[model samples]
Target: MIGMAMRGEADIAIGPITRTAARLNVVDFLTPFQEEGIGFVMKKIDSPLLEQMFHVFRPISLVCWVAVVVSTVLTGIILTILAKLSPSAEHKEASLSRNLWIALSSILGQEDCPRPTFHQGYIILGFWWIFITLIMALYASSLAAFLTVPLPNAPLRNLEELASQTHYKPLVTQGTNLFHLFKSAKGGLHKRIWEMMSDMPKITVMDEAFSLVETGKYAFISDSSELRFELRNKCDELEIAQDSFLLTQLSFVVQKNFPFKDAFDHQ
Candidate 1:
């Protein structure tokens, strides 16, 4: 409609179009009738506590978890190789799988692992014991702290938090102003959000965005007023994020330098 208006095919483009500096270059906007901002809409969490039960692994970060696993495997391989080379009569031959199991069990504080007889074996076992004990202590303390403390079940508060988590796939309609905002973004939260949405099929309609949000695994970003009006019937199931972004005025688009612009502004 904006192109049509610019080509002299239409005098004006109607509806709740956003007024932007870029759009003003090719067309003119009427006196903005309304002001609004972008918002995120998602299903409300009904049982935050139950949702948290599955997040037991949150006590350790992904990097730390990967480091622990890699170190444990490397320790097991070293122990197995040392066992093969040790000439002591007391050093029993063990398979790589057995040593791996021993390494895993020892980290868990199990008592069945046999004591090593050779000096190198003893040294390796000693260091491994100390390392595993420290890791266990840290994990135990953190888990205990998490269990005993009361934490707020805060809803998705802002874009930074939303972009950082994998729980919800944030979505925006294709070709809309909000979509273009992220698509053209070079860095930071907007870029992150665009990358996330790129994985799913392009969403073309607002209804599809609402359907995806209903499943609780996706969030839709759109005009706050539109979301409120559309989701009015499903207040209990869906909610808009408390915060908004990309605040702008909404107005109708008219041909560039339309003669009636002054008269339209008067009303």
Candidate 2:
């Protein structure tokens, strides 16, 4: 379209062509109709059944659980030793199994759990109760969060995340402004991404790229609004990632000396 307009085959080249410095030298752009930035579309993935089943334990780590178990056993052992060392005859007949049962029941908030027999035992039990209460409170809060928070639509939320991952290939429409943006990148994330996609197959059409995205293998980058418009009907299977970059105005192209520039800009 740009070439046609430049050659006088068309008076105006229309659509959401990005206004860039290089293009400006060859053709003039009407006042931008819209301003948008780059974004990506990818397929939505559901949490696996295995992940859903084990979500109950997501609140706490394995190491923390192990530590809790070790603490409970140690508390039980200390309580049994204290009972045997007590001066009172009534408190002297302590067993490890009984102490362990008491510790477990107390930690579980059991009302009928046996109490410590001596002063030292009571002090230790009090501290243990405090520790167990804290652990339980933390676990409850974390479990609530795990249950209520929805999973992300896609794992790659933004450009940085997409750049960091290796499994998903980034794609752009060939010969587009976005394509040029990466091709001309000299340094930073854009340059890195361009390098990464150097050997990957090129995508020439948005629909073709989106189809690949649906397979969970490719990410298509384009103007944010355009990506949204294209995915409006397919939202159940595809979604725009939470990224906006390469900000630019979109306008129609006209010949460099086109006479009606003001008339078009006003609309």
Candidate 3:
């Protein structure tokens, strides 16, 4: 369409024509009718509640769990030894079962356990309390963050992430403006992403590209507007990435010397 306008073979080229630096040199564009950006379309993420529930324990390492258990048992033993060495009969006769119960209760957040009677017992309990406090604090903060945030199926939120992953094929139409934009991108993240896309197989049709994305093995990089429109009516399984890059203005294209260019711009 842009070629037709540039060659003066067509009076105007409408539809979703992107106004790019390359196109601007040959053809004049009217005021942008729609603002759009390039983004990825992929299957919607569905993280199971059961999986999330299991993730609660992920913050604490297996080693940490083992350490906590060993510490609890050792603290109980220390309390029992302290009680045996105490001058008071009640402290001297403290049973191992009672000492272990108190240690377990304190670690589990239960405050019903009796206070340590001896100074040595108090010191052991104080150290155990500090350990429990730190462990609980870390677990609570990690679990809260995991449960409150929505987990995405694909972790590719931006072009950099998309380029980094090897699981999904990130694609663009071979001869479209988007392909050219990426191809001509000078250096930096855009250039790296362009290389990644170039390595992957290209799909010629938009529908075909979207269909592949719906299967969850591919991510289609294209116009946000078209992707949203198709997602609303055709592909419920598909979702667009939240972050968009390479914003392009959609406008009508006309010959460089077209007489009514200003008129079109005014409207």
Alpha-carbon TM-score of each model against the true structure: 0.59, 0.81, 0.72
* Model 3: lowest-lDDT 10 consecutive positions: 86-95
Evaluated with lDDT, which candidate comes out highest?
A: 2
Each candidate's root-mean-square deviation in Å? 11.0, 3.2, 4.2
Clashes of 2: 0
lDDT of 2 by residue, 1-267 (tens): 989999889999989999989999999999887888888988787779998798787799999899999999999999888888888615433888888987898778999877876788889889999999999999999888887996667778889988999878898888988788889999999988898788767778877788888888888888899888988799888878876887889999999899998888887
Better of 1 and 2 by lDDT: 2
Q: Ranking by lDDT, best first?
A: 2, 1, 3
| lDDT score, candidate 3 | 0.81
Candidate lDDT (C-alpha), each: 0.83, 0.86, 0.81
Task: Please give the RMSD of candidate 3 to the true structure.
Answer: 4.2
The C-alpha stretches of model 2 lying farther than 4 A from their native spots are 44-48, 87-93, 117-120, 141-153, 157-161, 186-188, 233-239
* Backbone clash count for every predicted candidate, in the order shown: 0, 0, 0
For model 3, residues 46-151, the per-residue Cα lDDT tens digits are 6689976777677778898899899888888888877888876374337788888888998777877777877878888898899899988988888788778866
